[model samples]
Every structure is written in structure tokens, then in C-alpha cells.
Target chain A: MKISIKRQYFIEQLNHCLKAISPRTTLPILNGIKIDVSDDQMILTGSDSEISIEITIPAEIDNEEILEIEEPGSVVLTGRFFVDIIKKLSGDFVDLETTENFQTKITAGKSEFNLSGNDSNQYPLLPEVNDADSLVLSSAVLKTIINQTNFAVSLSETRPVLTGVNWNFNKDNISFTATDSHRLALRRLLDKTFNTEISNAIIPGKSLSELSKILTDSDEDVEINLSQNQVLFTYGNMRFISRLLEGNYPDTSRLFPENYETKVSVNNSEFYHAIDRVSLLAREGGNNVIRMTVENNNVELTSNSPEVGTVNEAVNASAIEGEDIKISFNSKYMMEALRAIQDEEVTIEFFGTMRPFTITPSESSEVVQLILPIRTY
Target chain B: MKISIKRQYFIEQLNHCLKAISPRTTLPILNGIKIDVSDDQMILTGSDSEISIEITIPAEIDNEEILEIEEPGSVVLTGRFFVDIIKKLSGDFVDLETTENFQTKITAGKSEFNLSGNDSNQYPLLPEVNDADSLVLSSAVLKTIINQTNFAVSLSETRPVLTGVNWNFNKDNISFTATDSHRLALRRLLDKTFNTEISNAIIPGKSLSELSKILTDSDEDVEINLSQNQVLFTYGNMRFISRLLEGNYPDTSRLFPENYETKVSVNNSEFYHAIDRVSLLAREGGNNVIRMTVENNNVELTSNSPEVGTVNEAVNASAIEGEDIKISFNSKYMMEALRAIQDEEVTIEFFGTMRPFTITPSESSEVVQLILPIRTY
Candidate 1:
């Protein structure tokens, strides 16, 4: 394979391709990136079994020559070293050529690098997804959805299903939910453009997190194709494929209480900072638990460790209704929930001190976060 | 102890004090910051065995009240946690009060933190250095001298004396030298104002590095006091004390070659970037060795790995003097030396192909760096 490509463009695509390559891959071939050159464009692919990323650089972009192809062929080069070399190469254009024996020579300006390449034919084939079950959404929307809920997914592998973010599409509404038993984050969006009803897919939280980083926040549409065992995301001359987790996700809709024994509305930033400070002392006592008591228009948060001392903070609540309640919960969970609320004010609904409480943005009902209170005697 | 201080000023002083507190100290009291409240000012001190920092906040600075002292006493509080609490506290003024029993109460706005503190009497006393043997220099000059030579200090502790930078003061001239045997860096400055003839002291490179961070690059005078076992640096209401190494530092002055068979002048930045790129391939071959051959006005640098192929690049030298020669060395050392040269053009002098070579700034004689050539066939 022979091609001349702009250094900046190559570096940008290589960065995206690197996200799919894991250093701990047992298969040595998976540690390398496959390069395929055609008459008009060059495609780079990197994978580590769970996810694969393919980026295409056309011969010309926006009437400017970004890549010039001389021969059509394929080869696989070590991903980490190649990316590092490309990033540090001090030249405007890089020339890459591969011989029949898979020896690749990369040259740019006065510097040239020759690296041994593996046969591309030995690389795993990308799983195919049916186009009929595809949906298109704005990249910005997808990124927001992932960022809003992915953090709440279970970090432990004890329950495999909880390690992923469950996505359900019905009619024109798409809902994303993630939970780690202690807390849950849910985000929903309605798009009339997606006419096809697709089945629910459990995408590993880690995969969505990586995909979000590669997807720029733009108005461009990203086409997502779903199948029984695989899902594909195509956007901006790139394809990201991830394996779907095969398990039934638990129903979390009933987790939110219909009625609240007490409700308090407070400034999100003030509440977050207050909990953050109290958590410093709470963290020393183990479990990072902080207690909050609401009465009238004032809410007091306090935590103490016999060894490290205590912290007490009071934040003014806009309004409080029903019976005043005192609840003890994980400060980290509350802080994360408060940070995810984009609105200036958040309304927290509590059902006594033992049940899970729901926190929602005051301005929009599209996002909801629930935290189970820690029983502290 | 009781005082009310501006949050920003308190934070700045705490930061300097935090540097002296190491997390892995054997003595528990050393992990805390000592706070001594006087009638007119508040002094904060933190220390590990190697270094101690004391910062004083006057009752008034520039006619503005920076600290208000209601009582005079002393206490020691955990450094890391106290700093964290102060950083997150959201108030213009922080009020700290310590009882006779050493229970401290820190309050700001509506938040309050009560922390258990240790008696100041339990903290180790800082070593006192005599001002009679002191010399003063601008903070900027001291900072520059440290930065120019500290990187060459031996990182390994096998030779403890080489781990510190030797400061030699003679005839109103101060010279700092550091070497790890493989390479040496020397920075010299002539201070006519210092008339005293003081003995040389070997200051730990790590301590100097920390002191440099706390010293702002300004024209303010930093008074350095020398003692038998410790050195004190006083600048901007702060006093930093560092223990001195007892052993004699090896003499590295004679290591500089008196005459050279080959010399080359090249653009500092260009040479650095070229070596940086070539180092990528050299690194894969194990010792990160790269070779340079100069003849006439052309200089070629090349490095090869039997398994990764080879990279060769030619850089235009401004001048090449004496006999043509080939030399091989660690690319990292060469790159670091080139980076340390502040001048636009750098001149490298070689003494034979296997001996040590020197890289110096083309326009300044105050700094010199010597790198030993690697014997590669």
C-alpha cells in the first residue's frame, strides 16, 4: 500500500483509531492497526475484540488534496508506536509504502521510519449490522446522552448487565438509563425523524464513553445501525462498532416514587458545593456518608468522623413542602447527581428517610437521577 | 490561636507550607502544619525531615488587613486535609480558632469545620541558620540557576552526593554544578554584592526544585543563610529551610575538554526536533542510542532497530570545524542538553569519538552542559 497523506489529518484519524486498540489484548495482531488503501481513499482500522474503529481519509477533502494514492494494498502496523511517530513527525506530508512482504516504510520531510507489518488478512472481520434497523441522530445529542448517564453505570463486573447503559427506542422517543444499584441516571429525547422501532440494546458504558470522546459536538448526523449482537455508528468518515451485551436489563421505571413525603428545591451549584465540603470529613469515616435535614426554607448537611472531626453546612432552599425529613446518603452519589443536573435549580423528592429519593432539574423533566439513602444510626 | 485571614492570602501561605509536608513521614506530627498566632501576625510552618517552610501573614499588608489576630497561641493541624478544606471553603474571610486543648474550629460563611489538632509543642523545631554567613540574590536568578542545572542531577541514590547540586561560593561568584557521571550541567553567576567567603553546601536537588516552585520570578531579594547542617532561603514573608548533604560532591570541572577535534554549530530548535523524531526509532532498539556524523556543512543522524528498520535524516549545520567525525550517544541526553541551551544557536564540541562532549549556548558563557558519548559499533 502506498499513499501520501497530510500529517495533521493523519494524526487526527490515528487518534480516533487508537481508542479501539487496548494494550492488554492477548492476541498480538489486535495490538496493530490495519491500513487499507484503495484507488480513492485509505481506511485505517483498530480493534481489541470488544470495539473497533475505522476511519477513512479520501484522496481529496474540500477541494484540497489530503491524500494521494499510488498503489492499492493492505497491511497492519503496530498501533501505539505508529501513532506516536505520526504525532511527533515534523513534516507537512507523510508517505507510507508497504511491500509485498508487508514491510512498511513511512517517510516525512527528512525523517523516515520503517516498521515491520503483519498481514492484514489475519485481522478479524468487522461484524455487519442491518441497515433496516438503523437510526440517525445528531452527534451533539448522542454525546449529551452518553455523558449524562454513562457515569452512573456499574463499575463492577458482578452483574454484567449493570455495566452497560440500556437504550430503549419506542416510536419517536429514545430513552437511556444506567444504574449501579446505589444510584440511577436516566435521560430521554424525542426525535420524530427516527421512524423505525428498534429493540433495546445494552451498550457497555466504557464503549459509549470512548465513542463520546471521538464524536465532536456538532449538528452533523450520526447513523446508528443495530443488529442482534452488534451495533455500528457511522459519522464523519468513521465507523465505530461495539458488541452488544446479551442479558436482560432490569426494569427501573418503578424505582421512582410517585408521591413524596417531602420535597426541597435548592440552587444546584450551592447544594453541590455544600455536599462536596461535607464529604471531605465524611470520606474519613468510611462509606462517605453525609446527612441532610430539611425544615422550612433551610437545609443543613453535616458529616463527622470521630478521628477527623466534623463539617456542617447550611444552604437556603427555595421552598420545602410536606413533613420535614432527615436523610443520610452517600455524599459522592449526591454530588454526582447534582453535577449532572444542568439546570440552575434542582428539585429533590424524598419518601421518608429509608426509601430512594429522586432529583430532577427544575426546568426540564427529561433527566432524572435517583439515590438510595444510606441507613446511618 | 485565633485569627481571621483573607481566603486567598491564607491559601497562598498554606500552599507554600504544604510543600514541606511529605505524605510518607515516619513522624505523625510532621504530617501536619504548625500554626502560630502572634499579636501582630500569623505564622504557618510545615516540615518533613529534609525541609521545612514557614510563611508569615502580617496583620496588615499594603495598609489592607490581611490577618486579624484576637489571641496568641499555637497548634498543629493535618496539612493535606486542612489545605483541602480551605480550598473548598467559599468565603472572603476564614476564621480559625484553636482552644487550649488543640481542638480547632474553622468557619467561613455558613460552613464550619471542626478538626482535631496536635499540640504545637509536639512538632519538631526548625533548624536555625545564621544570617552572618548569608548572601542575597534576586529570586529570578536563583530560579533560573536551579532550572538550568537541576535536570542533570543524578536521579539514583547510589551516590547520595551526586543527588544534590553543589553550590560553590568564592570570590563573589556563585556556581551551581550537578552531574550523574554520564552528564554534567553547570550554571554560574557573579554576584558582586556578596562579599563574604562562605563554604560550599550541597543542597538536595529535590528540595531546590520545591523551593523554586514557591519562589516567584521577580526582582525581590531572596536571602540565603548557610549553616553547618542546614540552609535557609527567605523571600517575600516566607522562610524555607533545607537540610544539607554532608558528603563531598565529586569535582566535575576537569571533566570539560580543553581542546576539541570536531565542533558543529546548529539551530538549537531544529537539532532538538530532529533528534526527538529519530529518538522514536532509537527507543525501540533498547538503549535509545542515536548516531551523528558531521562532515563539511552536513550533519546526518541515524538510528536503527534490527526488528523495526532504520531512520536517517540530514540537518544543515551552520558551521563544522576541525576534522570530520562520527559519534553516537543517548538521544535523551542530547535532546535535554539542547533544550537547556537558551540561545538560538548552539555549539557542540567533541573530544575524540568516545570521550565526553560539551554543548553550550552560542551567545552566553554562563551555562555549560557535557554529555558522554556512547560507544556503539
Candidate 2:
């Protein structure tokens, strides 16, 4: 394949593809990025078994010639070197061509790099998804949902399904849920046009996180298609496909508490800072257990390390209803949950002392964060 | 002891002192910062045996009350935790008070922290430097000289003196030299006023690096004092004391070659970029060796990895005299030397294929960089 493209734009696209390239040594060929030069566009593809990303640079963009194609062919070049070379090349445009013995020559300005290439055929092909069954969502909403719920996914391999965030699409709404058994996060988009319905599509948390980073906050639409074992997300000129987790997702609807023994509403920033300061001492212990006592309308947070000292902080509580209670929990889990909550004030609902508590935006029920209290009796 | 200070300025000073406090577990009291509040000024000091930093905050600066010392006393607080607490505290000013048993209480806004404190008397005292015999130089010049030569210091402890940069303060000029046997960097400041002469004061590279970071580029003067086995650097309200390496520094004046067989001058930026590109491929091997061939005023740079391919690049030469030569050296060393030369054009002199060559700014001889060529044949 022979193609010349703008160095800056190509570098950006190559960086996107690099998000899917893993440095794992299991597969030697997977370390290279597959490049295809078509008659009208040049495509770059990268994969790491579980996730694959492909980006296309058309010959012309916005009436400007972005790429010039000489011959339509395909080759795979080492991902890291190719990227570094392009980024450091001193020119406005970069030329890439393949030679005999799968050798690729890249030139820009007065610099030339000859890199050994792997056979494109040896690279794994992205899983094909049927586009007929797909749902469209705004990129902003998709990014927000991913950032909010993806963090709670279990990072262990014991339960594979728990390592993914479950996406359930119904006729009227779409719901996203992630839980690591100790904590859970659920976000819902109440009304959006959906062409299909999915009961259980467990998307890997890593994939969602990467996709969220790639998807800049925009009003543009992103079409998501789900197959039996693969899901494809197409936005702009890029396609991101991820292998779905193979297992059944547990029903967590019952885990969220409906009736609570105590509920408190506090300013988000004040409470987050208070807990953060207290956690500095709590973090000395691996469990990071910090206690919150709410009596009347006063909320006191305290944590102590055995050898180090203690920290006691009080945050303003705007509303305190039902019975007052004292609860202990992992400070890190609560901080993570609070960071995902996008609101000025948050209301936390506690079910007695040992049961889990839920923190949600005080204005709406669209987002819910639940954390199990540490039994530090 | 009781005091109230602005958290912002306090944090900045604490960070400077933190540089001296290493978590090496050699001395338990070294992990804490000793704070002493006199009648009008508050002093913070941290030491890790080898290096000690002391910062002073006056009761009033520029007609602004930065500190309010209710009483005069001293206490030692955990360096890391104290800094972290002050950074996260929610208030403009933080109140600190010490009670019996050396227990310290820190309060800001509604947050209160009681931390275990070490006895201030146990903190190691900084080495005393005779301020009468000292030289003063601009902070900017000191920073520049440190940055130019500090990188060449040997990181290995095989020879203790080699791990420190030798500073020779002569009557006419001040010279800074550092070498790791493979490469050497020397920077000289001509026509500087000197109070005394220093023949062999080897300041540790780690200490220089930390001191360089603390000294910002400014016209403010920095006082340098060298005593028996310690060097004191005083600037503004901060006094940085670093223990001198207790060994004789080798005479490296003979290392600079003269009457070169080949001489070449090239654009510094272009040549540096070429070597950087070639090094990308060369770095695959640990040595990072790249070859430079100069013929008919044309410079060609190339590097190859056994399994990977090669990189070839050319940089424009402004002047080429003497005999044409082929030399190979570590690209990283050459690149680092090039970075220290602040001139747009650089001159390189080569004696032979395997001899140590010199790279100096074409405009001035204030800075000189020498690197030993790798023997490929």
C-alpha cells in the first residue's frame, strides 16, 4: 500500500487506534497496526483480542485533500515505532509505502524510516455486527453514562460478568448498571428513540472507559449495535468493537434500597472534601473505614489510624429526615461514587447501620450510587 | 505553641522542605518537619542526613499579615501527613497548636486533626557554613549551570566523587563539570565576582537536582558557601544545605581534545531531531548507539536494530572543515549534550574514530560537551 497523509491528523488517528493495542506478548502480530489503503480512503486498525478500533481517513475532508492514495493494498506495521516516527517526523505530510518482504517505508521531510511489517492476514479480524438492530444515543449522554457507571465494575476475574457493565435497552428507556458486590452504580436515560431492545449485553468496563475517552463531548449521534458476542460502536469516521462478556448478569434491581431508616442531603463539594480529609487518616488502614454519625441535622465524620492521629470533620447537612444513624464504610468507595455523581447536592439513604446505603442526586432519581458499609463493630 | 498561617504559602514552603525529607527509614525523626515559631518569624526545617532545607515565613510580608504567632515554641509534625492535611483543609488560614506530650492540633474551617508529633529536640541540626567566605551569583545563572551539567553526573555509586558535580569557583570564573566516564559536560561563567576559590567541592548529583528544582529563573542573587564537608545555598528566605562528597575529584582538563582531524557545524535543533529519530530504533538495544558519517559537508545519521529495521536521516551542515570522518556514539548522550547548548548552531570536533569528541556551541565556548565514540569496527 502507498499513501501520503497529513502528519498531524494521521498522528491523532493513530493515537486513537493505539487505545486498542495491548503490549501483551501473547500474540506477536497483534502488536502491529493493520493499515489498508483503499481508492477513496485509508483505514488503520488495531486490536487486542477483546477490543478492536478502526479509523478511516478519507481522501478529502471538508474540501481539503487529506490523503493521496497511490495503490490500494494492506500491510501491518509495528504500532509503537510507527506512531513515534510519525509524531517526530519533521514535515507537513507523511508518505507510507510497502516494499518486498513485508517491509514498510515511511518518509517525512528529510527523515526516512524502514520498519519490518507483519502479514495483515495474521491479524485478528474484528467481529462483524448486524447493523439492522442498533440504537442511537447522543455522544454526550453515552460518555456521561460510561464515566458514571464503569468505575463500579468488579476488577477481579472470579466473576467474568461482574467485570462488565450491563446495558439493558427497553422500548422507552435505556439503563446501565455496574457493581463489584461491595458497591453498585446505576444510570438511566429515561426517554430516547431505540430501534431495538436488549435484555443483557454485558460490555467490558475497560472497553467502555476507552470508548468514553475517545468520544469527545459532542451532540453528535453514536450508533451502537449488539450481536451475540460482540458490540460495535460507530461515531464519526471511527468504529470501536468490543467482545461481550460471556455470562448472565445478576438482577440488581432489588439491591437498591426503597425504604431507608435515615436520609441526609448535603452539599456535594463540602461532603466530598470532608470525607476526603478524614480518609487521609483512614487510608492508613487497608480497609479505609470511616464513620459518619448524623444526629439531629448535624453530620460528623471521623476516622483514625492506630499509630497516627485522628481526624474529625463536620459538613453542613441541608436536610435530615427519618431516624438519625451512624454508618461506617470504605472511604475510597464512597469517594469514587461521589465523584461520578454530577450534582451540587447529594442525598444519601441509609438502611439501618449494617446494610448498604445509596447516594443519589438530590434533584432526580436518574443516577444512583450504592455502597455496602464496613462492619467495624 | 500556637500559630495561625496562610495555608497557600505554607504549602509551598513545605514542598521545598519535603525535597530534603526522604522516606529511607534511616531515622524516624527525619520523617517529620521541625517547625519553630520565634517572636516574629516561623521557621520550617527538614533533613534526611545528607541534605537539609529550611524555609522562613515572617509575621508580615509586603504589609500583609501571613502569620500570627500567638506564642513562641517548636514541634515536629509528620511531613507527608501534615502537608496533605494543610493542602486539603477548607480555609484561608490554618491554626496550629501543640499541647503536652508533643501532641499537635491542626484546625481549619470545621475540620480538626490531632497528629502525633516527634520531639523537635531530636531533629538533626543542619551543618553550619562559614558565611564569610561565599560567592553570590544570579539564580538564573546557577539554575542554567546546574541544568547544563547535572545530567552528566554518574548515577552509579562505584566512585562516590563521580556521583557529584564538581564546582570550582576561581578568581576569574566559576566552572561546573560533571562526567560519568562515558560523557562529560562543563559550563563556565566568566567574570563573576568571587569571595574565595574552590578547587574540589563535589556536591552530590541528587542534591543538585533537588536544589535546581527549588531555584527558579530570576535575577535574584543566591549565596553559595563551601565549608569543610558541606555546601550551603541561601536564596530569599530559604537555606539549602547539602553535604559535600568526601573524596578527591579527578582532573578532567586533559579529556578535552585539541587539533581535531574533522570539524563540523550544524543547526542544533535539526541535528538534535535527527539523532532523536535515529535513537527511537537504536533504543531497542540497551546501548542506543547510532552512527554519524560526515562527507563533503553532508551529514548522514543511521541506527539499526537486529530484528527491527533501520532509520536513516540527514541534517544540514553549516560548516564542514578538516578531514571527512565517520563516528558512532550513544544517541541519547549526544541528544542530551545538544539540549544543554543554548545556541542555534553547534560545532563538533572529532580527533579519530574511537577518540572522545567535543560538541560546543558555535557562537561561544562558555559550554562544552564531550562524548566518547563507540567502536563499531
Candidate 3:
């Protein structure tokens, strides 16, 4: 392949595909990025066996010439080396040509690099998923769903299914749930209709995390195609394909408590800061447990490291009604849950001292968060 | 101690002292910052045995009230905990008071923390350095000297003296030199008169690294007092004390070549970028050696990793007048020396292949940098 392209634009596309080329890939070929150049555009692909990302750079964009192809060809170059050279080049445009034996020569300004590339035919092909069972949603909504639930997924691989976020779709809505058994986070979108053949699937939390990073906060529609073993996400000129986790996800639908004896409405920042201070002392010890007491419309947090010190902070709450109660839970888990809510105020409901409590945004109950209380008594 | 101080101002001083509190400190008391309250000012000190930092907050400064001292007392609080609390407090002012059993009450806004405090008397005392042999320097000059020489200090403690920068005082200049045996970076201030008792001393690289961070970019004069075992730096109500490295620093005054067969003048940035690109290939393996060929007034750089590829670039030079030379050297060392010089153009003097070379600013020879060449067939 012989082509000269805008260095800056090419670097951006390279980064998106390079995300899938993990350093820990077992397959040596996966560490290289496959670049296929046709008459119309150039496609860059990277994969780690679990997730594959492909980005396209067309010949001309917005009437501005982006790429000029002298000869159409293909080559797989080492991901990090090519990326570094492209970014550090001072020239406005970079020229790439594949010589005999798949040797690629890259030239920009006075710097030229001749890299030994593998034959593109040796690279593994991304799983093909037809647009059959496809569901479309706005990028913002999809990113929100990923952010709110992905953090709560299990980090352990002992239960492979728990390492993913469980997705269930109905005729009118879709809900995402993730839990590490110690805590659960749930987010649901009721407006969009998810009409497709697939009703449920467990997507790895890591895959969704990477997807969220690349998703722009625009109203652009992202089409998701699901197959038996793979799920494909396509938006703009980029395609992301991830392998679905096998095995049955835990039934956490009944994990949230139904009744509560106490309810408190607290400002996110105020409560967050209070808990952050109290956790300072709690973190001094092995167990990050902090006690919280809600009474007289005020929430008080207390934690102490016997050898270090103690911390007591009073958090202002808008409303605290019903029976006053004191409970203890892991401060870190609760802090992560509160940050994910992204709301000014949240309503926290407690069933009892030993039972799990739920926190939801005060304006909407679409996002539900639950944290099991620690037996501190 | 009982005092109420502006939280923002206090946090700034706390950060300066916290630099001395290392997590690897063997003495537990060293991890705590000692706060001493007097009628006129409050002093905060942190030490990890190797270095100590002290900052003072007066009751009034520049017609602004910074601290209100109610009583005179002393106590030591854990460094990280206290610093974290001060930074996160939303209140304009923080009130600190030591109560029974040395438990300190820290109140800021609605957040209060009761922390266990160690007796201030238990903390190690900072070494006293009188102003007998003193040197005064502008903060900018001091910071520049530290930055230019510190990066070249030996990180390995095998030759403990090499881990520090050797400062030799001349009648009208002070020369700072550091070498890890592979490469040497030397910077000399020829204008400053040395009117002190001490002729030379070695300061630890770590101490200078921390001191460089806290120095501001102003022309404010800084007082440096040198003692037998300690060096104290006083500037803007802050005192930084570092232990001196004992033992004879190696004599390398003759390392610079007196005669060179080749002399080349090159732009700093041009040569820097070329070496950086070439290193990308050499770094693929363990050795970071890159070849340079200077002939016909152009410096060509080439490097290759057998498994990766080869990179070649021509660096623009203003002049290359001397015998043609082919030399190999570590690109990382060259890049670092170039960055530390802070010069637009430098004149390079090469003795020959496998011989050490010297680089100095084309404008002047105040800052001399040396790099040893590697022998390659």
C-alpha cells in the first residue's frame, strides 16, 4: 500500500484501534495493528481475542483531501512503534508504502522508519455479525448505562458470569444490572424500545468500560448487533466487537430490599465529603467500615482507627423521616455508588441495621443503588 | 496547641512540609508532622531523617490575618491524614485544639475530626545550621542549577557519593557536576562570587529533587547555610534542611576534552527530536544505543532492533567542521542532557569514536554536558 495521509487525523484513528491491542495478548499477531487500504478508504483493526476495534479513514472528508492512495495494499505493523512514530512526526502529512517482503517504509518530515510487518492475511478475522438482531440507542444513553453499572461488576474471575453486566430487554425498555455480591447497581432506560431477537446477555464490564471511553456525548445513534457468541457495536465509522461471557448470571433481581424503616434525602456533595473525611480514619485500618446515624434530619458519620485516631462528620440532609437508625457499611463501595449516580441529591432508604440499603436519585428512581451493611454492632 | 488558621494558607504550608514525610520512613514519629504554636506564629515541621522541611505561618502577614493563636502548645499529627483533611475542608478557616490525652480536635465547617497526636517532644529535632558559612542565590538560579545537575546523579547507592551532586566553589563561580559513571552533566555559574568557608560539598539528589519542586519562579533571594552534617535553605518562611553526603566525591575536573577533532553546532530541538525518534527502535531491545554519522555538514542518526526495524533521520546542523566521525551513544542520556541545557543551540565537541564528547551552549560555555560514547563495530 502506498498512501500519504494527514498525520494528526491518522493518529486519532490509530488510537481508537490501538485500544484493543492489549500488552497481555497471548497471540503475537494480535499485538500488531492490521491496516487495509482500498481505493476509497483505509481501515485499521486491532484485537486482543476478547474485544476487537476497527476504525476507518476515508480518502476525502468534508471535501478536504485526507488520504491519497497511489497503490492499494495491506500490512500489519507493530501497534506501539507505528503509533509512537506517527505522533512524534513533525510533518503535516505521513507517507506509507509497503515494499517487497511486506517491509513498510514510513516517512514524515526528515524522519523515516522502515518496519518489518507481518502479512495481513495471517491476522485473525473479526467475528462477523449481520445486522439481524440489532438495537439502536443514543450514545449518551448507552454511555450513561455503562458508567452507572460497570463499576459494580465483580472483579473476580472465579464466577465468570459475575464479571459482566447483565442486560435484560423488554418490548418497551432495557435495564442493566451489575453486582459483585457485596453491592449492586442498576440503571434502566424506559423510553427507547429494544426490539430485537435477543432478550438478555451478559457483556463483560471491561469491554463496556473501553466502549464508554470512546463514545462521544452526542445524540448520534449507536447500533448494537448481538449474536450467540459475539456482540457488535457500530457508530460513526468505528466498529467494536466483544465476546460475550458464557454461563448464567446470578439472579440479583430479588436482592434489593422492598421495605425500609428509615429514609433520608441528602445532597450528593455534602454527604460525599462527609463520608470521604470519615473514611480517612477508616482507611487507616484493614476494614473500610464507617458508621452512619440519621436522626433529627441530620446524618452523622463516625469512623476510627484504634491506633491512629477517630473522625466524626455531620452531613446536612434535606429530609430524614421515620425511625432513626444507625448502620455500618464499607465507605469505599458507598462512595463509588454515590459518584456514579451523577445527581445533586439522592434518597437513601434503610430496611434495618443488618439489611442492605438502597440509594436512588431524588429526581428519578430509574437508577437504583444498593450496598450491604457491615455487621459492625 | 489551640489555633484557627485560614484553611487555604495552611494547606499550602502543610504541603511543603509533607514532602519530607516518606511512606518508607523507619521511624514512625517521622511520619507525623509536628505543629508548634507560639504567641506570634505557628510552625509545622516534617522529617524522614534524610531531609526535613519546616514552614511558619505568622498571625499576620502583609496586613492579612492568617493565624489566630489562642494558646501556646505543641503536638504531632499524622502527616497524610492532617494534610488530606486541610485540603478537603470547605470552611475558610480551620480550628485546631489539643485536648486531654493529646487528642486533637480539628473543626472546619461542619466536619470535625478527633485525631490521636504524638508528643511533639518525641519527634527528631532538625539539625541546627548557623549562618556562619552562608551563600545567597536567587530562587530561579538555585532551581535551574538543581534541575540541570540532579537528573544525572547516580540512582544506585553502591557508590553513595555518586548519588549526590558535587558542588565545588571557585573564587568567582560555583560548579555543579553529577555523573552515573556512564554520562556526566555539569553546569557552572561563572558570575556568582563564592564568599563562604566551605569550598565544596555533595548534596543528595533526592533532597534537591524535593527542594526544586517547592521553589517558586521568582527573583527572591534564598539563604543557604552550610554546616558540617547539614545544609539549610531558608526562603519565604520555609526552611528545607538536608543531610550532607559524607565521603570524597570523585575528581572528574579533567573529563572534558581539551582538544577535539570534530566540532558541530546543532539546534537543540532538531537534534533532540531526531535522537528521540531513533531511540524508539533501539529501545525495543535492552541497549538504547543509536549511531550518529556527521559528514557534509549533516548529522545522520540511525538505530535498529533486529526483531523490530530500523529508523533513520538527518538532524539539521549549522556547522560541522572537522574530521568525519561515526559514534554510538545512549539516546536517553543525550536527550536528558539536551533538555537540561535549556539552550536553543549547542556546540558539540567530539574527540573521536569511543571517546567522550562535550556539549555546551553555542552562546557560552557556562553549562557543559558530557556523554560517553559506546564502542560498536
For candidate 3, what is the total of clashing residue pairs? Answer: 0
What are the chain A TM-scores for all the models, listed individually? 0.97, 0.97, 0.98
Top-down DockQ ranking: 2, 3, 1
- Tell me each candidate's TM-score: 0.97, 0.98, 0.98
Of the candidates shown, which would achieve the greatest DockQ relative to the real structure? 2
Candidate 1, residue B164: Cα displacement in angstroms equals 0.3
DockQ of each: 0.77, 0.85, 0.80
**Clashes (candidate 1):** 0
* Candidate 3 chain A: worst-modelled 10 consecutive residues by lDDT: A190-199
Q: In candidate 2, how many Å is residue B214 off?
A: 0.7
Runs in model 1 deviating more than 4 A are: A190-198, B190-197
User: Candidate 3 chain B, which ten residues in sequence have the lowest lDDT sum?
Assistant: B190-199
Question: Could you give the interface RMSD of each candidate, to one decimal?
Answer: 1.2, 1.0, 1.1
Candidates arranged by lDDT, highest first: 2, 3, 1
Off by over 4 Å in 3: none
Q: What would the per-residue lDDT of candidate 2 be over residues B114-207, giving only the tens digit for each residue?
A: 8888789988778899888877888998899999999999999999899999988676887889999999999988887465655658999999
Per-residue lDDT, model 3, residue A195, is: 69
Residue range with the least summed lDDT across 10 consecutive positions in model 1 chain A: A190-199
